[model samples]
Target chain A: MSNLEQIAKLSGFSKATVSRVLNQSRHVSQPTRDKILAIMEELDYVPNGNAISLSKGQTMQIGMVTEGINEVMLPFLNSFVETASQYGYQTIIYTSSGDPKKELQAFEDMRRKRVDALVISTCVNDLALLGSYCKYGPIVSWQRMENPQIASVAMNQYDGYTLGLEHVISRGRTRIANAYGRPSSINTLGRIEAYEDAARRHGLAELPQWSRTGIHSIRQGEELVREMLAVEDPLQRPDAVLCSNDLVAAGIVSEARRRRLRVPEDLAVVGFDNTELAHTLGITSIYNPIADQAKNAFHLLLAKLGGACEPQQKLQYCLVQRATT
Target chain B: MSNLEQIAKLSGFSKATVSRVLNQSRHVSQPTRDKILAIMEELDYVPNGNAISLSKGQTMQIGMVTEGINEVMLPFLNSFVETASQYGYQTIIYTSSGDPKKELQAFEDMRRKRVDALVISTCVNDLALLGSYCKYGPIVSWQRMENPQIASVAMNQYDGYTLGLEHVISRGRTRIANAYGRPSSINTLGRIEAYEDAARRHGLAELPQWSRTGIHSIRQGEELVREMLAVEDPLQRPDAVLCSNDLVAAGIVSEARRRRLRVPEDLAVVGFDNTELAHTLGITSIYNPIADQAKNAFHLLLAKLGGACEPQQKLQYCLVQRATT
Candidate 1:
């Protein structure tokens, strides 16, 4: 039998009166409500959350979609989950595994589930398609989209790249080489644009051979040093290298030490994303405030839910100087 | 007006007929059903998922609770989510942040939400309380609990410790020290029992000063070497150290190299959790198959949902030897 029916049979009360108590309707007498609640506790009964949410016209749940997670996104996800939980919202996570079709399916699932809001950590679909999803609920993207209708909270990637480049240049190191991730990624494209702009402003010729893509790991950093730095003539090699992240910079440092090359004297290295690995290795890096961005993203979605149209927000990054430079 | 009301009005069908069509009742004529469905498509009507689920007697959702994530739990969570998603189950996450009260509250939330199953990554609550929750849904714990009523999937810590110790013994190291995480933790307690038993069997003296607790990070490994290994009498110190994890092992190796001490010949280091950091730093570690454990946990929960009483599963660890040993 259903829980309400059992309660009604035991309390000698009608099902409608029992439901009135469950819904906290003032029409029910105080004694009747107390008796129904006591019987509920005795039976260890839990009311249907779905029914309650349906009556309230809100689910009090958020749907979060990501292409996939990496070291950079891990803490952000954890922080976002914690913050949302504190506000009484449960986060349903859907990892698309870098598939655009899967991301679209996740949205469809959310729409059918009727979540209160949507948070897109990664999206590869067209902006117009994403904007159309706004009808289902308020949508927020972690990456900046050109569509004004979608709320976005993202870090300024161009400024981060410029920070790393300027720090190396400040140390009087010209002829700088660059190591980056996938060329097609939005972040990498922004960095490439900033690198070229900085090189032109500094009157430094951009050498195609000096720039390497798909450098994400420490081993990749070491490989970059081997392929570009170990030249017959020392002056032919770049004096400084700008890495995609701390792992790549760590690789460069380890490789340089193995070859008995002095850092800053023989080669200056700058890394991005000041992770603990960067701090431990003392590599100069650009600090990306991922935790802060995650917290703000939750708040931005909350604003959208509150019927406020928030403008796109761009957070900043700063350079943390350390032993490498 | 509600989407259902609009669809009924547009199709010129009675509300009862519209709901019957929505529920796929054969009593509704084919032409009437088609007309209703067409109007639904034009109105972009998404049926109330909660109401549909209420009638089906299942949520098609799972609830996962964790006591805050760490490097070890991150991949495990991702793998579990991906596996669950592939099976058409949406995962709702709640992070308790190591608070027992919060864990209890999360259980209450899951019970109200009526998730099909519950996955507990970490819990410090009483087992009897968790056992009582079985009425709400099946519960699967990542950590091993003494309660036979709750399903669990955990790595064999004692065997893992023995594997690391035996490997070091084979390398001709007699006096070995140990670095561990919180002494009160179940994993550490198991390791302590294994270490004493192995020492007694091998006729090696168990020195109190050789054991260090709360050693988790790379910096702690460096500090351990500085405190114990910098002794003037080389014979008085341990020839090798067993680390709590790869981060500690990496620290030991880095500090030893900085102090001009050769690894293995001077201080052999064995680590746990065979992470990529261990591979990059070349530390011999006991490989804990977290991804496999996560996948198995989901399958075990599925078995529970199928009414199968599964026994507790203890996964094994293997030693991966590298340059550090």
Candidate 2:
């Protein structure tokens, strides 16, 4: 059957009236409107959601909140925005500058703006405020989550770290040091556990000075590696170094170059979250499924918006072997 | 003068009444309200624009149309959103996929949602439809603009290219090549002009085989460099290569590594945009003022929303010399 005939039969209206409604040319009577609406529901007709939302005083817009914007957040943000746009929703963004007060303010403002949904990738553990916003709209956690009330799409950080450690061990490296992130962060805890577990499993001694934790930055990576090299005992010097992230790993590589040390020969290096920088540097690192997590976050939010059952989603990670390993 | 007393005198209301009104605890008569409002206006009393906008039914929300949701756009988007949030306004984003049709749809959706203002970074020369939306609310261009009616904040692309090219020439390299972007893009055209001018200034013979143009991707950069190197003319081969952007330069670097060529010794390479990848690779490149452009665009939109005169703004770029040079 033709589209016009289908619409006419579904709406119980004449073809001319259905055409008028579809074209948005003129107003139809109240009874005709009710009949057409019923038919549209029965036919499962999907009109342009944007146009419908526009007429209904809502925009179907979602909000994305994160820490300070940088190259690190680019890939994930892009994926989330593009995927959400495909679903006929626009995205609003907020950056917290790593300040707790600023983060709270962003959440309050986003809530006041009445965004249809929200996705937060924050470092703070105060999830109560975000949970309050969920009462008004769906909230999806990205990477970090402390509240079970909110749905989350997160990476298996422990597994990623384990994979990286296994790869390093397979290369016959017995003496290893780790440059990790802050101990306060949940991601850091996972990595620390995995690193220790891998050492125990391999029957290698875990040294106190070798298990270093600090902020994830290039300078920190350089400093940690320098400290490791400065150890007076030649036996204490590590044969390999594992970094918290790609930026840190790049720093380690740069410092190694400066000191004329050959990577994977003098000291093998590994990183996490195989970012674009890792790809450019040819550094072997753990590849977290960032785009996949973002896609799943959007899908989870959509499910909540549709009043569907919620489930905990954990994305997998893999070790991408390269020159550094 | 005390804040309360100043407000009281400015509004021509008693201290008690002023306090009551400020706290929204009591109502005043219409005549008294008119007198107080006139007095406040005469004194140039500045009430919070955010509170007033909220009370007037405006959502205090703005929309940003981005080119892509990748790393390049992340820093700019984050800054824009943070700044807008400071003014108690939330930002809605639309990713245009670099397609004019998707861009138009974003504008239509934002317009239908009655967004107070918009900032567009994705360039689409044709603005007839966007112009119609501009009449209803403020619309500011972020990176590129072809329409005279829309206000824009742009980076000095020519100046940036000039600096990058001059740096390469100053290094005393006679045979220089460039891995440029799409010929249709204005930014690419500027870089090409700068490349030609710089080559002539250095008294180097320009070779057609050495100059390459393609999509801004690592694979394209690798392929183009390979194709150029395949030419049998030994004397015509360039001693130095300049990439249009950091990603392309990285690809060239990777290819060079594959061919066992040492960077800056066997072949000097430079890149544009000085992104994080450039820093990680230690590649010398120009720094485009993405954040500045975004900030300026938001302020321009804010000015227009305030019913003030808007001016065209252009930000300057800087050259960052790194290890690659």
Candidate 3:
């Protein structure tokens, strides 16, 4: 007889019960699990991980696919890994580098590996393509996509942008230009809507030329500010600038300081993603709450894995005021 | 007949050749592999991942255990993941939170999961304990431990510290203080040795109390500088300060600026790790070649997996001067 059968026979338990104990199922009673485990130990039955996984129909692994591995994503990924480990699951991470083809390849690879669930921060906007994979396992996205099949967790970007714009206005700045991230992202779209609404409400002109896109890094911020300063028309120049993130804001501050321009007196800067860069540089920023979002995403995945449905979650954001403004 | 036997009969090849083709072994010729693959496709046979792994004694997975998941380690981890994926391997990451017990637990968990190899950035200094694990699989450490059994990749910390110190001295700053990370770490020990040696070579008194430890953050740097500035004796005050990392240096600069003290005139500051933080703050820092070390570590693991040994490698460090110095 096989070792599993031997353990079942010696422990006076059915084969299914012995299998449950081997898989560490909660249905098995403590004493029964102890008896079965002791018998298996005595018989020197070293359980094969692959064999056990095949039998149980579960790999105890979660696959995480992101557009890129960066400082912005590191804290979220770290929190998710920690939470997943606490639930006795390991995570396998893949980066798609913002390519749709590579993202689909990652999904296919995760399917073949038979991970229990998938958490994706996708660069692609097509939900139909993501929905077709639901047959394999549950998926949790980092963006708030309007799909009935996929669960999601995201920060309220519109409110975050509103907070930054209003803070600048409250600080007595009227002529404000904006620098934001990729134009195609839902995050950027939401922030743009907020910015337009705030400009209209505050009786400020919505200058399409002043608001720029594709500003994600420190160097980009510096370049954008230099370009703004180059316009000899002082009226066209922005008295204040709202940046896509803290990195860009730091760039603007650094470059502005190099020109001997005093912050708040010459230009007020507002940044997003209140990261450590914002704190150290004392740039007023919008806190993204990425760790909380990551934790919520894991809990949503758990609910789905347990054959339950959970409502999509949208977390809140706040403004952190500092020296730059 | 079993599927393997049927494939062997139909293809007129031995079972070993069919098994070798199934495992994607390089020994199989192209024509033979294509023919076998065509037949297998015609039969609609999908290979099971678990069964394939069990039969081949390989998992095609690598385990990465880090002390903590922070911005400092993110770049290294990202590079390693990209390189590993190029070689058809996925990584499983675990963070030990700087606890030796948790580190050991991660190792045991990886062993039970049967990962093909392990790469660790450990907090513990016990090389003997690490050497004992070689019987399971090859281990690559991020620190340069003097063990012939394990492969290692590390930056020359002494050289990195020397570059920063010498740069400050070249800029005419003779009275310099130091604020660094954990004293127990080899990196810190190496930096301290360099600092003492440089001070002695220049015929300067090495004030034991001036070189402070247990500093790894911006707040600590701020606190250390505040304490230093409070001393009434201007003769005992340092003309310059070398920080352990960019974050601490940024803190010193920020705090000094808050007190209206001019940087590089009243107090010069140097930082290690020429990260984006350093660049944004314009703080002069030492450039650590983490990506090179990660790539080299993977190549070492590849050699070991191919039944060969490799020598440990220590990458170089250089200084990048900015306005702060």
TM-score of each: 0.90, 0.81, 0.87
Looking at model 3, residue B237 earns an lDDT score of 81
Chain A superposition TM-score, candidate 2: 0.79
Q: How high is the lDDT of residue A323 in model 1?
A: 82
Superposed by TM-score, candidate 1 places the C-alpha of residue A238 at a distance from the truth, in angstroms, of 3.5
Q: Scoring only chain A, what TM-score does candidate 1 earn?
A: 0.88
On lDDT, who's better, 1 or 2? 1
lDDT of 2 by residue, B1-325 (tens): 8546886777667888765665555477767766766666675454432333334536577877766765556657777887787777778777777788877776665444446778886655467668777765778876556667777777646778888778777887777887777666567777778877777777778877677777577777677567756867745667788787888888878777777667777577888777777776678888887777777877887777773444545566788988777
**Tens-digit lDDT track of model 1 for B22-85:** 9899998899999999888888788877777677766767888887766657668888888887
* Listed models, DockQ each: 0.57, 0.29, 0.50
Looking at model 1, residue B232 earns an lDDT score of: 84
lDDT of 3 by residue, A132-212 (tens): 777678889887666778877876689999999999898888888889788777788898999999999999888788788
Model 1 gets an lDDT of 0.81
Off by over 4 Å in 1: A12-17, A25-32, A182-186, A217-223, A229-234, A254-265, A307-316, B12-17, B24-33, B182-185, B218-223, B229-234, B255-262, B307-316
lDDT against the true structure, per candidate, is: 0.81, 0.73, 0.80
Ranked by DockQ, top first: 1, 3, 2
User: Whose TM-score is higher: candidate 1's or candidate 3's?
Assistant: 1
Candidate number achieving the greatest lDDT relative to the actual structure: 1
